[model samples]
Target chain A: MEPWTTAPAGPSSAPEMPSPGGNPVGRVEEVLAQFFMDGKLRAAATDPAYLTLWEALEQAVAGGKRSRPQLVLAAYQHLARPAERAAENAVLLAASFELLHSAFVVHDDVIDRDTVRRGVPNVSGRYRQRALRDGADADTAAHAGDSAGLLAGDLALSGAYRLLRRVRTAPERRERLHDILDEAIFASIGGELLDVELSRSPVMPTPERMCRTARCKTSVYSFEAPLEAGAVLAGADSSVVAALTSSGRHAGIAYQVVDDVLGVFGHHSRTGKADWGDLREGKRTVLLAYAATRPEWQHIAHLIGSPHLTAAEAEHIRRVLTDCGARDHAISVAEDNARRALDFLEHDGVPSPLRAELTALLQGVMDRVRPE
Target chain B: MEPWTTAPAGPSSAPEMPSPGGNPVGRVEEVLAQFFMDGKLRAAATDPAYLTLWEALEQAVAGGKRSRPQLVLAAYQHLARPAERAAENAVLLAASFELLHSAFVVHDDVIDRDTVRRGVPNVSGRYRQRALRDGADADTAAHAGDSAGLLAGDLALSGAYRLLRRVRTAPERRERLHDILDEAIFASIGGELLDVELSRSPVMPTPERMCRTARCKTSVYSFEAPLEAGAVLAGADSSVVAALTSSGRHAGIAYQVVDDVLGVFGHHSRTGKADWGDLREGKRTVLLAYAATRPEWQHIAHLIGSPHLTAAEAEHIRRVLTDCGARDHAISVAEDNARRALDFLEHDGVPSPLRAELTALLQGVMDRVRPE
Candidate 1:
């Protein structure tokens, strides 16, 4: 009856783990949503402008399933009772993910000049549109929007600190909270700087280099830190914490590599990502690496670097990516990560119920990560 | 003796005490110097780029006389033992002043875009010059420098938080430290926003509005917060803290108004400011307020708004400022502040020894601040 192994091994538990609180996934999301709303409401009295940011934050938090936090809490549940009280800690961890995610997105939008995200106008774009609608001239509206977005992002970053300052953890747990947040932010910012720098001058643009950038820039925040923070906060043993980061590192890379694949081949409706998004940005994704390795690489590169490439030209580049088997390679890499993730689950000291759900979650991610 | 009133208040003591560690004025400068150097060194390890910022920070910090931190510490000393552990609390208070000042300079540099500051090339200016020397094209170099300056300022801000987080004050003291730092930064930011909006719109250019902006934006960070934080950290009584804030507020406004005068009328070599700096930038200072209120207001306003005003014409405007006695009026305001500051030193609850030193410091500042 241990939490780590309630579900059977591999890809067979999807039907058994029903919705609502019957399964850990449903329970984790439900708890996280309520917790996020409550935290936002508590601070509403301080400033009403923040309420607008809180709403945007809630939406941006939704695309990711509660994978990292669940991994942490499931691991914790294996060692102790999984009850409502413990869920409070889980909520904190989940909200940290959302806050951290919003910080990255805000900064990323600035980097990419991305006008939209999640099928709606992104933060910067929203402000720009609002300014124009408010009767400002075009250039003034654009400048105002950019300034508002920049300041709003600054506010969110501070808001993250404010949230962490209120954590009711034991003194020992609390001491490490600031360190965790600071390190993650610093690492992510460094990675972002490198990512932006490399776009202009792809220093040693090897597949391996691109993967390192992906893992550090995106994966660490998206996965490893959240999982590791949760384990540490729950008072898990160092050994268990080490396992969480290891599994998280592998899973995080896999998620990003698949994300790269989806960015190229997936439709706008399913992933809420623009078709050929990474291709247009000249993002040095692993798929792009495969394209680089081809004899026709120069031709594909030319189209990518072209500003006025027609739809036909864009489709041709897409076909070349598929023809080079870049899509297949990306999926294989994702599967490799899932297999490695399950390997970590099977380690001898893991509690069974936690192991079962982790294995199920890994399989679920792998299945969903594949293109429809 | 109460720390707030330990200094002698006789007129004979005023000329004797204001220079170095021999009197309260000297002690404040000594304390601030040590605090600024130690803080810069501690934060220098963050990155190689930060070392460049630290250099700029060190330079920007030294330019201001140790007025605010000194006032705070002297006020604290007047309420308690003049020399009793005052050094330790003074360093903390001095650190707050420098950090708060650092924040203002960074934000102000962003607004002004004048690269040289405090007799040295500013962070933004350095970046611009280096980029051009590195053979970046003209437009690229300018853009690079602007962005570098923005990021440099952002890093300095983060460093401020890092400094505050490590403060070892008692719980109640810790609570005020939070309030002081947060409220000062928030208020200054609000003021900067208002200034930016006004510069764009020119609709709400009332003298009262400009003075309010000056008080909220510069006064708190420049004078009040540093003094209040020092007194609070030293465990001084509330009344002492209140007196320090009110006195510091007036002094801050006076200092800025004097700065406005120098920006218009002073020589570049003496003031380390371009003679036409404020005129070139079109800053709306207290001088502008005076011009707006004069019987010859329309004539002056026409010249200020005109695009064709030559350097000679700008010098004529400066002559008119002197003729209207606006410069004298500003000096009188500074004298009024000095008197108010000395009166606070004479409060009955203040200790005699501290009060004597404070009275001397006030006189010294007035001497230096007086129009030449």
Candidate 2:
């Protein structure tokens, strides 16, 4: 049988993928930790002030899910023969995904002017706080903070390429590695650009349009590319690569759809997001687009993007969304996307054990957004 | 004769380097043009709004000196065998330098909050204008503009790596190609980080400290790395590469010194810089650092870094700097560095024809910065 289409082996035949050679995700963490350590050393050598950037970067990325790297490992292990899998190299390549994510989240904070991220002060927020402590005025402090964020994000972006380049892959595959990364970055930026514009546009985007943006902005890089990169690295056939990539695309959009729902509904403790932000900013997510289609939206439309959105007003908006079935509407869309993602694994391209693992991973991340 | 120690040859020995290939610099420009054009198409295909970013990038870099690419060509031709001179590949590499520059300048504008670049509105400025014209408030418009700049700069940064990766070169040298570019980017970012921090620091940095910052921020990638990359591509010995790299470092510092002088004294018409900005921002330039050392600085010290600095106050500050011998002090430092740069050619590693071309290139660029 073709390696891509092989049947799943029993539990014994399933190699220890994530924990192979003892917790591979731990290796990705180590790569990141070491990369930042060297960065700190270099910054200290250059000027002590630069250490602030490296420190902020290290701090911001410290508690990430490491999902991207895990995806790489899963795809690689599923496709590669035991002899072909170089666990260490796979870890390095996977680490690059987290680095790229750091770059995106950092810059996105700057664009959104968000001081807090993941229930903590983000890179810009940290810098801003430091500047304020130094007795600079609010404006100067804000400028300093965002500048640091911009510079730090640049480092992470370039640093991602550095980590990717370090993976000891075949010479023939190296250029493809870089090409996939570049393409993913390109699509992600486009998604970000479209997303912000949609919020600011006079005409509201439809749910479908928002979904397209989600696929471009979040799904392509976050899900599709990582899976594709892993398959490509494992030398999977092109058809298998495409199938895996398409599956990832659907899963990523599902992730985004659920993310939008959680942004307004999930508690800060549960999701690391301020429930007030998405509604206050008038972010045109699939959830909001669904709500826009309801007659009740007219009564609460002003509440959606109010700069001084109160907890009371937000609660009222949330209630309206739920009553109008907008909440369920958005949830069903996410379910459809997630189901579509799982369908790809059910077919010939993926192994059965791989199928079960991907299904679990998708459900785990999306559990909060899914119906209890 | 050993290639590194080859004696100066007559007219026949000198190959047609820059023009022999019929304006390779134009090819570099072509590569950049095509890259931006494709970016625009992709943006258009995704959403028309993204075209604004590609347009801003294309415009931001259109009138550049192309000095970096020329430096590459000179270094490569000076060392490569006639048959080894693949001009197209060399142009692609050189063009990456410019792409990186575009990223730096765009991000720097966001950091500096500069509205104008090269005597015109910059990337942020353009986006800000469009937003305002569309009826957005001042704050909203400014946010839109900077967001665009930030996103566009990210594209350019990634785009540089793409271009660098595209250069077809010897397999052994490939990793080195990426390594050199990464090292240069790392140093350049370090330089930018320090440059901002220096201007913001409460304690004034000395002229020596400022010069070191200049070396990291402007010189590393601009001059040193380009020459080193070119030499490495042409398969120059490590020693030759080191010499040329050192030569570029000194020359780059000279260029920065002159730029500081120009920032305060050179007209917008001449240098494409706002004469008032450096003084208004209390920018801790090498020139200002020298001025701070003179006793006369006590009389007008308060005017520096004054956010509301008047035109007359700026004129007074310029005169104080000049009369205090700070101007000559800076000019002398620039001259010393330039002389040091040229002295590298006086050694055995470089050939005479290459020496003459590099000399002309250095002087031509510095002519505006140097005294008549």
Best by DockQ: 2
Q: lDDT of each prediction vs. the true structure?
A: 0.59, 0.80
Instruction: Identify the runs in model 1 with alpha carbons over 4 angstroms from their true place.
Output: A1-101, A114-142, A202-204, A271-273, A284-295, A303-306, A323-372, B1-104, B107-151, B289-297, B300-309, B316-369
Docking class of 2: medium
- Which candidate leads the pack in lDDT? 2
User: Taking the tens digit of each residue's C-alpha lDDT, what string does model 2 give over A19-57?
Assistant: 222237888888998999988998878777778788988
Candidate 1, backbone clash total: 39
Query: Considering summed lDDT, which 10 consecutive residues are worst modelled in model 1 chain B?
Result: B1-10
Query: In model 2, how large is the Cα lDDT of residue A262?
Result: 73
**How large is the C-alpha RMSD of every model relative to the true structure?**
8.2, 7.0
Q: Candidate 2's residue-wise lDDT over B94-207, tens digit each?
A: 899888888888898898887667557888999899889989999899888898889989999999899988888886787788888898888888888888888888777888
- After TM-score superposition, the amount by which residue A280's alpha carbon in candidate 2 deviates from its true location, in angstroms, is 1.0
Positional deviation of A328 in candidate 2, in angstroms? Answer: 1.9
